[model samples]
Target: YGAAEAGRDYNTTDMSRQRMYNEYLPPYKAAVEAGVGSVMSSFNDINGIPATANKWLMTDLLRKQWNFLGFVATDYTAINELSAHGLGDDKKVSELALNAGIDMDMVGEIFLRNLAQNIKEGTVKQADVDQACRRVLEAKYRLGLFQDPYHGVSEARAKQVLMQPAFVQAARDVARRSLVLLKNDNQTLPLKNTANIAVIGPLADRPLDMLGNWSGAGDAKQAVSILQGIKNVGGATIRVTYAHGANVTEDAQLIARLNEHGGQLDIDPRPADAQIAEAVAAAQKAEVVVAVVGESQGMTGEAASRADIGLPGRQLDLLKALKATGKPLVVVLC
Candidate 1:
């Protein structure tokens, strides 16, 4: 959050041999030694060649030197984008990648579309293709896929195994451990049951935001939101009020981008000043105010980047308004 100077962007990385081995190769080597089932080549090029078509890095270094017998998969359309990296066309790149060590293609049909042609032209050998296929089949054999691919995968099985007592306890443990409290002075917590508490911000009652990104198989509706937690934890005697003080951001382009895959954040449709006023009013009538703020799930993870990683939208303004109320305020970054 503007804590340091911005570093220069090296769009295409070009590093010396010593730096490559010292910085990057060690981790790959460790993974290989740890018996990793497969390796996915990254999008960026190293030195002068794309990872998808780097024979020195893949075959000679990974397979021969390190004895990594597992198959190497291409990251998304890395093989197809070889041309974009100024390497070659589809057929040419396919040949290069296959010869290099890419046994599996992820999301791109470059190999499926061009491998036969490459073989006919004698650019890729039958032996090389056979080697790749053997490694892939070997992996499948290890997984017992040849016998039964869908073993232990059924509704009845899921019901029997999922969310068992031990798993639930583990989940609770992880949740507790994940919490990072930066500040909590003057015994702000353990709220007095008779106190009137106002919970503010759009995030306070948003169950979807609690699920986070890549919540694989997790249902957002099942999550207990911040408002619910506060109400439940504070018990029956605590009078609580809620106000959606601000949306995650006011930028229309950002909202659209975040919702491109799905609606991770919902903007209030109501005017900003009106929301702030409601929050301020809530704070005015409360003994203590709890403001739920910070990132929506889509603001982080792969392909998501930020130049100024501060509190998004008019949340700062919302906090300022609540602060003006002169009530004891608790800031909770979700």
Candidate 2:
């Protein structure tokens, strides 16, 4: 149930929304072709209502039109999410969910809370309910859940799968390619061998923020942090220093949330003055100041953006201060 807006923000213009919709349809159609069994949409409300209750998305686009042979599940309580999106009251939201062909509602209390009234009001037709239930049953049948739900479990298979060389290689390739090179001025593409160098930044020494949203399957212990990567590339001797410098934001509430959810990238968002002082101190002492700054993981990704693009809090002040140190500043904006 992902929103149609592209480029990490939900305030997509009408023209941009149409373009994103066009881009989104083809991949979904391909997934159907690959014989997918079920589709669970996302948490963000798409357009007006959450994608879970959006009939236009599940029914019109995926089921009736694309002929997807899979049951559709909402991101989470899409019915309740409708209320949050300000689409309608609870009863109306439940009616919308069934009509939209959501086979199973997750966390949406409407199915349990107000279904009877929805059915009585002519707001939802019985046929729509039946269709959704039928789709769920079909999915269960295809999965052999009714026949033998536990058919595919085996210790031997699990061991063999883990040992598969191809899977290992694929994982390695994914890890390597996922790294985005932020700067390579004058073909400094591959880092040169230098005996003494400083890896300075709040984020440079940390690994947790590398994976953003929906990073459901990664092991923090298994991931290589930026600092770790540098150490592994032993061609050059490296000197590394980490400064938590400033928190990602100055807002106390925002910092508290980031502390819970953000990896290394998230920190105790501090006052602008604090951040600027730390950054300026570091810059004054360094030959090159690699100033990594931006919104924290919670600040600007999926459904996050600002009318003002300038750095939040006193971070911009920190940057200005760093520039005053006269060290070359190379910033990495996420």
Worst 10 residues of 1 by lDDT: 1-10
Candidate 2: tens digits of C-alpha lDDT, residues 42-129: 6566555567667777888887777887788876565676677776888877877777777788776677777768778988887777
Kindly report which residue stretches of model 1 are placed more than 4 angstroms away from their true locations once superposed.
Answer: 1-14, 190-194
How much does candidate 2 score in TM-score? Answer: 0.71
TM-score of 1: 0.89
TM per model? Answer: 0.89, 0.71
- The lDDT per prediction is 0.84, 0.65
lDDT for residue 13 in candidate 1, whole number 0-100: 61
Pairs of colliding residues, candidate 1: none
lDDT of 1 by residue, 151-187 (tens): 6689999988787788878987898799887877788
